[model samples]
Target: MTDLARDGTHPGAPPPGVTMSAPDVDTHCPYCALQCGMTLRATPQRVEVRSRQFPTNRGGLCQKGWTAAELLDHPDRLTTPLVRDPHTAQLRPATWDEALDRVARTITGLQTAYGPDSIAVFGGGGLTNEKAYALGKFARVTLRTRNIDYNGRFCMSSAAAAGNRAFGIDRGLPFPLADLAGADTLLLVGANVAETMPPLVRYLVEQKARGGNLIVIDPRVTATARQATLHLQPMPGTDLAVANALLHIAVTEGWVDKDYVETRTAGFDAVRRSVAGYWPAQVERLSGVPVADLETAARALGTAGTAIILTARGAEQHAKGVDTVTAFINLALALGLPGRPGSGYGCLTGQGNGQGGREHGQKADQLPGYRRIDDPAARAHVAGVWGVHPDDLPGPGLSAYELLDSIGSPTGPRALLVFGSNPVVSAPRAGRIQRRLGDLDLLVVADFVLSETAAMADVVLPTAQWAEEDGTMTNLEGRVLRRRALRPPPAGVRTDLSVIAELARRLVGDGMAGNGTTGGRTTGSATDGSGTTGGGAGSSFPEDPRLVFDELRRASAGGIADYAGVTWDRIDAEDGVFWPCPAEDRPGTPRLFAETFPTPDGRARFLPVEHRPAAEEVCPEYPLYLTTGRVLAQYQSGAQTRRIGPLRTAAPNAFLELHPDLASRLGVADGDEVTVHSRRGEMRAPARLSDTIRADTVFAPFHWGGAARANSLTNDALDPTSKMPEFKVCAVRVERA
Candidate 1:
């Protein structure tokens, strides 16, 4: 790493675009969880994004982050609400009053006909923490529906499930991401940081500069793989076997940290018995990693003074995702990795607010402050803040996939309100989910663009983007960073907070339960949750984000992912406030599990897990494995990134990446048209021959839609615990189109 990489500038170099001295607002990127620091300037022509000093990226920006300003005034950006005409059945421009009133009337009608559960809410990981918090409250208090969940369920639910059972808590990294800079060894199970997060590569380089080893394990030779000291190309859906085998070798080689296991962890004996059969030769035969490479990887990780293990979607998007993550955590534990400074297991969260999104009421099973909804104590505490009885709050709802699958069924909601997500392009078995969404009695989508999902919505409400809003977002490190609005939203666009508040007002302002009231603060009354009348909050639905945060702080005062002390002023003074800060005077916790574990016994647990075949395995009919991932130039579902000119030009179309041997066997040449068929559906794209992938597998980016939609062929088999659909690997066969 050079001094320039550290300082983000040279002696006399010019800044990103506009002068930093004239920066109108300082905030983070609008893309991934890196939340790279940036300064927005009001250039003569448009809003300019210039690199600014911050910890996550050190002022470095990827192409997607650099070109983000283009979306501020994109020609396709929606500036008015669109409502489906009752007679023509076509979306047409409408006033905000008409659109919101129609949605509110539909909501009342559906609930009156089918009950409160007739309405469901879907959120996204891209929303600010304030939005996430308010959305959850809206679903529970105003709508009184038990069916609320978010897209983060697809991103890190597996890792989160594993983390909770083992460590008794789940914070994406549990430590600052910068800690990787001083690590002796880094084992990236399935993450490709070089492309997904370019700025994070600097930490890997620094570790290598210190004579440390960087090991990468994946089916394809990704750009991150090219930078590794050693690359272990395992079979698709077999990384768990590799992890178990490595731990087996560590035990045989006497590399186990017996002292740490004896005192800091539990259930070692069960794990020891579980992994006894995962010998080197067996794993080599099962995973195709070869015994020698496994041995070397085991040695590098086990012998290191301080080593870390990380997992991503490739390893956590399977039916056995939680168990697979547990396998790696088991290895990290056996090596005495976690709870010791830079050496531990962490998940590299994908979305911009993935870490915080799951914490505050967006997920099906959680409430504000990362408290479980089913827990009576948690329910009572949060209900108090909202001025409602604990019994009045709805119970846990269905997870993301199940909610979508049940869309029009007898057990599912008849109406769905979507916020900041595009499941029609991102969901597994998307072709089917698309039809389910179509069956809804009323479908409302809030976004800045007409995404594939929004295109099918009965009502589309244009909402504000990141640069046009002031709120907070928690990055991968659990640090709560402030997002200052560079400018107000365009003329016809409004913030999601405003939309939610207005709808709540329409539903409850007349002292009518959204489902029709019996009067006297019974149903969705005019009261704010507590028995207060018109004075305290003015309206139960407060549109200002700051007011919502004040409520969030009070509600989360004693909860696990505590944000009681994390004020906006505090966030501005410090780089950002880490969570578990219970009071204004107490410093936030940057590194969890540094002293005592948060479990009942004050120790981490060793949960034993085994390798299992993918939900859909290859067969004679479907002889090849298919995996999905993100491309460097495009983000998830390409809702925003694909709209940008430069990004669209960089990755203009989706392509089927196949090994030369496979392409030759199938009689397909580079740029030739090819179609891939799976049990769910099929997708077609131009053939892209690349020896970087395994001969038995094919790859495609899931950022495009229509015939190129890779998700159309993905399996929907879900993890039992997390309900996460297996989006990574499925059985498929290919032929020239």
Candidate 2:
């Protein structure tokens, strides 16, 4: 490794023999959506992390952020490409040229045999904004396939869907996290912020100190629930009923803000009629929450001068996730919270770049700046930016789960390009998804380590890690921040941007051309690639992050998440800039919809919703309800965090958290091995008995793969609107193993 300054200046750039101390680079943590600011000092052996004052984390770093530097030089980090041999059926180290050529040839052959859609690309929520934008453009311009989607679909699609429908825009948070300090009440629905993002817990403490109330709703008595002034322990999958009952209580108690509702919102009459049947008693019977607690929670929210509702995966990872989120939005709207100064509705995004990943064109049905793919105007605007014909771009494709389920089928994709995600362990029904990957004719993966998903790939391309890359990430507040390169990548390793650009150049050389017209025109010779592709000769993907962001600004000019005004220099000069900053002179809008909503009528819409049972109901044979979540020591799938010695030792393996009564009934003591059997499969793990959880519900962290994978028992029932899988609740049977 070579010494470099925080401004990305190399020591060699100075006069010869001039000794320069390695300057600490100001960068953000590579963990969650919080994107906590940190300074990194690069030494010969390792990198050191120190907290930097930022609005999101405020000079704080979680355990994961503090230990993130260890991942850069982990013993198991991949340094070279690996290609599987057809004869030996084993992965062998290979040069970059050989590995990339093999991948390109395999994809081309599959396209020739099955069609362009036969090759699909799957992205991850943790990818930087530049990488996500490039991946989407690659899929449309190079592969010319409508089969591109990302892991964000499984994380926050439900919340995004509801927010788009209600507010005419989808941002995880319309206001900054600091606003929580001024709120009169904070209602957290199924979100364990204390354990998920520890720094955020301070806001709740500040609210309490200011004589405000805090409400937590979860099935278990999580760490966050312990600090709440009122905790409503509702049964899993019944959050809709609880929300409706709260609205019903507000209406009956005359707590609704008549002036705000009448002037700033619409469809309240229908929502009021819909919740008329969900009284306190009925809600208690359905959601297992006491009537007294429900009334108390409702009263606190209704009486507050300004209140905010925050939700997480626990509330949105269900078959009726969209409806559940919509119900929460309805309650916020009735109280006139959306555009209020100190109140609104927001979702806590889980992944590192989850907010930015979905804003670009990585999702199936969206273009850059969160534009709809099916809209002609949006297509024209983006196509012009890419120097391609509008008709050359493929229409909306299958979503994340649907694309995975289509593998190996007659009309499914035969080849897949996976970047930044480990679907083998993260996707629902892990056993089935593993088989689908095995059935693919060609599988290519670009990752820093040989993750569970990468181990199954035919060609694994080693890529640069976060500390070795320069990019941008949008935090939960829709604030775009910079990620500076702290050190050079290891020899033989490449950034994802470089790899994608090189591969696109090779594919374009094979005769694929961009559509030459300005209008819709389907080219011929799909196999020969002689016809015009969307971004044929005109497409030139720059490997530099700054250049990619410049093109991104043009593509996102007029869309909902406009970022034309955001520049790398501006991000580095300030803490961060919020999106919808469409002009260079604008300072960026930190808070949106202050006086009016984005709808045509400038009013928020309230949708009526009803409660539904879990996708997989408990039966006589499988009497226990199974729920999955994360632990503090590990991140999603533990692909990178698990490699660190300290973090791995802290959380050695997964375990089942069951109630004392349930464990005793099953004849299992603490640390006893138990077999959790579900309809799809079964997993064995040690059981730890605790009284924090409900007697009928058992919890397991979903950060491990193989024998301890929690997704093996998760249900894949999709929400009709958001297409989110039911990962929170399922039926299972527990027995002493």
Candidate 3:
């Protein structure tokens, strides 16, 4: 193995070398959703990234993005495919042929014994657009399975439910990040952007410079809250109460957008009546915010000429996540924030290409282009494009939580395939999910690292990382951009698409494609049923992304988005172009609802939401509220970044964040090992005492694994509507080790 030497770059170091050898090779930092544009300087032995001028971030990259290059060729990376002995739990390196054959046989056997519904596939938001799209299609058309979902269910399902109910669509933000700087007021409901997306948070600083009023609402004094003009530390699970009061004030004070509501909305009367009982006084009791503070926030949001509301996982990780998000939108509508300049509800996406992954049909209930699979018309449209019979398509299936539970049981799925996601670490009730995976008849996983999830797989296929793959991604604001591959994969690794193509052929026969070698290794039976002839003997399967995208374009015919003008040829000429560009004759819709909405009556709907209790309540046995979140140095689950030298050096291990006052009462001090136990599990980690959080609440970074895995202690109960797990509010007890 070759050991790559570092070029003296730290996680937070600035870019170096102004000029690059290849100009078109200019790319963006491959971390976080911020996606700071950068130019690459390639020397004979090393590569350096230099910040480039771009609209989103003014030549700035966070620690994770700046040090991404160091992770390109880590020594611990999985370089070959391995097939594990099911009975002995022993892994052996095998040719691609042997691995694919074993996987195909197991899937077929599982289908024959338990039916096609007994096979499932799990996807991730971090995968490139092309890879995510292909995985969804393969699960349905080739494998004929209804159980397909992604980690987004754990991350953004609440925000999606809110958008679909409020505005009849689910794009993150109507306006771009730059527009935030032009607003008169910006309300950050549940996000800590300064610590998460620091470069993008520059817009908020600029807005403050313009005399814009910034309001931050959270249970803690987060980094972003310290910079806000007003900070309201509401009690836990009480955001809905505060939001309803704001709406009550808007309606009573005649601040509601009467014309917009009367012209383009539904269910206003129900919402108005529901919020009537939530006056400032009553809400002040429900939430920790004072009556005066609630009134001040309402006035700032209502009287301001332009304002917007931004939410994050903090608001959507609760048991009532969907209801809380809807309340937020209702507050925005009462203040006339949507369908206008510099004002709307924006969800800061957690994954780099989460917006794109959802749009491309990787979600459980959705098809390509945000089309619902349950809708016959949408099914027909997509089926026609894929050249399959509508009757062949599967119906809506279980979400991630249900899917995980379904593994191994007779009535549950027996075969499971994973791509780019580590469920063993990210999924709630991690111990249960791990046991279920081990009990499966077959489990196949493709990743760059031997993640905790992959460690239990029956088959493990090494795949190329982001820097070794060429594709595209969609940003939080629905902007599409290119992902350029700057180097080649390690010795025996291959692209994800290649493995999927081979597996699809083995299961469904020649109908899938040819050779099954998509820029990867080739061995053994090419007879895994890949060819040009099947139902239609002479028809050829389109394997190249350029060809598949054309069919996708045709699938979106006549909808709000048209792919007629968006050809691979066109996209190749530049970085990339946003969709709904429609044609060469039209410009892309930068902001939605500028004139009208896509709702049935051309009006948004007001969802009457009520506050609900957390999944579990604090008791004598579990007396603390445990909240999970991320740090700037690591991504979710930390499969790749945590393995890198720079990232590991910054924050070496997980620590429990507790209030100093609470620690004092408990006889605990800084750096003292403590045991945190929940209803399902317990973990011991060093403590960090701080006043940033409430005395009754504790915080943990959800990126560590092993005995310290945070999700193991998280509650698995899901929101009835969105099927999102209760990751934020879990009851636990802490004591000295």
lDDT of 1 by residue, 267-350 (tens): 999999889999999999999999999999999999999999999999999999999999999999899988898888899999
Q: In what order do the candidates fall by lDDT, top score first? A: 1, 2, 3
Model 1 TM-score relative to the real fold: 0.96
Q: lDDT for every model?
A: 0.88, 0.87, 0.76
Give the winner by lDDT: 2 or 3. Answer: 2
The number of clashing residue pairs in each candidate reads: 5, 4, 1
Error of 3 at 166 (Å): 1.3
Summarize candidate 3's per-residue lDDT along 106-152 as a digit string, tens digits: 77666766677777899998887777777777766766678899988
Best by TM-score: 1
Pairs in steric clash, model 3? 264-603
| TM-score, cand. 2 | 0.94
| lDDT measured at residue 621 in model 3 versus the true structure, 0 to 100 | 89
Better of 1 and 3 by lDDT: 1
In model 1, which residue pairs have backbone atoms overlapping below 3 Å? 386-529, 387-529, 387-530, 388-529, 513-524
Whose lDDT is greatest here? 1
- Residue-wise C-alpha lDDT for candidate 2, range 1-737, written one tens digit per residue: 01111212221132222223445998998888988888888876678777777898787666677778888988888999999999999999999999988987777777767777898999999999999999998888778889999999999999999999999998998999999988899999988876677667777778999999989999998878888899898888999999999999999999999999999999999999999999899999898999999999999999999999999999999989999999999999998888889999999998989999999999999999999999999987777666666778899999899999899899998889999999999999889999999999999999999999999999999999888999999999999999999888999999999999988876766653222221124322121122232244324578999988987887898899999999998887877889988977889888988998888899999999999899999999999899999876788999988897766876888999999999888899999998899998888899989899999899999999988899999998999999999999999999998
